[model samples]
Target: MNKKVVVVTGAGGVLCSTLAQAFAKEGHLVAVLDLNQEAAVNVANAIVGAGGTAMGVMANVLEKDSLEAARKTIHSTFGPCDILVNGAGGNHPLGTTSKPYLEPQDLNSTVDGFKSFFDLDSAGIQFTFNLNFIGTLLPTQVFARDMVNREGCSILNISSMNAFTPLTKIPAYSGAKAAVSNFTQWLAVHFSKVGIRVNALAPGFFLTEQNRALLTEPDGSLTQRGQTIIDQTPMGKFGSPEDLVSTTLWLSGEGASFITGIVVPVDGGFSAFSGV
Candidate 1:
């Protein structure tokens, strides 16, 4: 590697921060990008203190103008981008149903606890889609221009386990992530000759801050839902932030040059085993 400039969106998130740190350690000029300006700057400062070249940029993935500004700043400072990590994505509660399956008795009953598919707010659904789908698309539009006609350039999109198979309750997220996987393949084919490698990472069941409430109870124990998930997982444990490093590093490096348009699941056999 010739110290290529690498940009990681959502650098404030746990998974993305780790990837940013890994790139920093490898001596690449890192651009830590996030919706939160201060958080992104903090990650960049941490990298700088550890003897790496880095710049912090604030960007809203859904907004084209803001992303364009971010690209200009990074281009001027670190030259063109060689690696792009599309890590800025998440789900919304409004887009989620309270139960996995709808019950007829629950429809007319005004229960404070249950929400049906009809209760899904359109704004939340649109927001989730814009965040995960359009969010991934626009960032690529802004940053990938630098990768065009260049050698050793790649883009990594973050997909979820639900992408391969939809999970319960989060229909919007599942659909959006599925689109991400499909888009990864579509973009890979479109940009093959332009020298940009497009791929995705489907991470499964990490109890990050984003989904901690859904996975665990307030008393610091696994909730019923969490237990069910653990039982289903062949590994019988949740993944740690470090668990994904190997796959991420390999996909970002020259070792994966021939690989593109594939979604590599970093799950503990979650996508492979069907409990039989």
Candidate 2:
């Protein structure tokens, strides 16, 4: 395959950082994009040290102006983007409920910091929605414009297992991810004529900085929620970041030329099990 310019949003995060490195290793000119400029720079520097071409860029997927600026930088630095990995997404604490379910008594009860489902803040829900769903949409608008009719051009969306079925106590995240998966299919069909393949990866539980506290105790043992996830997962463990690398590369390369509009699960059988 010819060398291509790859852009990865949220490249500073654990999963995306690993992905950025993997793409760089494949001899692609990587544009490491993140809201956190420092983290993005670090990842890019590491890639450069390891003999990969990369440049850290600060961008906000929510804002078109920011993305446009990033586009100029990327185009001038490494030509138009051939691959875009929409990886900038995470859940918010305020969008989560203190308990998994709601009861009549809980609605009237007033406890400090205890939020029932009814207490879910609209702003929090909107923030989560915009972060995952709109975030993915806006970046595609800005970047995919350049990718149109470009050979080997493709998009990889970062979906979650929650996209398949709602997870407990995190309705906002689940809904947002579902939107992402839905949008992935929509984009695949929409861009098919233009030669941009769109697909998503609905990853199972992987302990990252965003969900570290929720999945593990302070002592590093699995939390109750984490254990529950493990029990449901036939593999009985969290996936390593590296585990996702091969599939990501496959979808980005010509090997998956005929594949599009599918959400591949890297969840280690989590999606296949029915909890029976």
Candidate 3:
């Protein structure tokens, strides 16, 4: 089997780390890039320990220079990246409102650290938007330069269910993810002639480290918000990270050579459900 070079940003995270490991298991030379060098090394070391080829490198998806540096390192280490996964994105507390909807008297009342839509921090909104949208964009700009004419080279952007519809209390995250989905289609169309297929994976309600506290309690029980998600989802449960692996592998491989510019949902029917 020909070993392809696969690069996954945010590979240190629970979900992306799984992707990195899976790619390595399939005999691809996986480059696990993350902002945290130690966390990335842990994931890469695990893959190497299992006798798969992988390397961990520090990379900030929001920074072009950081991505360019990482790209150079990847090219020198494992050759040009045949597959790029832009998985660096997350929401912030300050970007979220304390309540789903604003109340009449609530607007007049004063409470310490009570963040409402009116009080949402500008810096927080900017950070969240940049993290999810620009984070995906900058990395693609740096990596896709190498993939332009390469055979079987593709890009996968990680979007979210919020891209399809706005979720309450998380306007910033929802908007950012929407941008990611839109960018996927734009890139796919622009790069179609170059043979670089660009697509997006809009994963629904996966209980990852980034949202663990919000979704689950320390007692291993689902929070009220989490239960509401499960109730809305047609499958009546949260999706496992492994559930997305097959689709991701298929999309990244030649098996889905004709698939591009689409946002494949791996949300256990979450996206298909309506509150009927």
User: Residue by residue across 150-246, what tens digits does model 2's lDDT show?
Assistant: 7889999999999998999999999999999999999999999999999999889898989999999999999889999999999999999999999
The TM-scores, one per candidate, come to 0.97, 0.98, 0.98
- The C-alpha local distance difference test score for the whole of candidate 3 amounts to 0.92
- Report RMSD for candidate 3: 0.9
Of 2 and 3, the candidate ranking higher by lDDT: 2
Per-candidate local distance difference test = 0.92, 0.95, 0.92
Tens-digit lDDT string for candidate 1 (103-206): 88767868785679988899999999999999999999989998999999999999999998999999999999999999999999999999899989999899
RMSD (CA, angstroms), candidate 1: 1.1
Between the candidate structures 1 and 2, which one is better when assessed by lDDT?
Answer: 2
Looking at candidate 2, the ten consecutive residues that score lowest on lDDT are: 101-110
Question: Could you give the candidate ranking by lDDT, starting with the highest?
Answer: 2, 3, 1
Model 2 clashing residue pairs (backbone):
none
The list of candidate 2 runs beyond 4 A from truth reads none
Clashing pairs in 1: none
Instruction: Give me the overall lDDT of model 2.
Output: 0.95
Cα lDDT for residue 105, candidate 1: 76
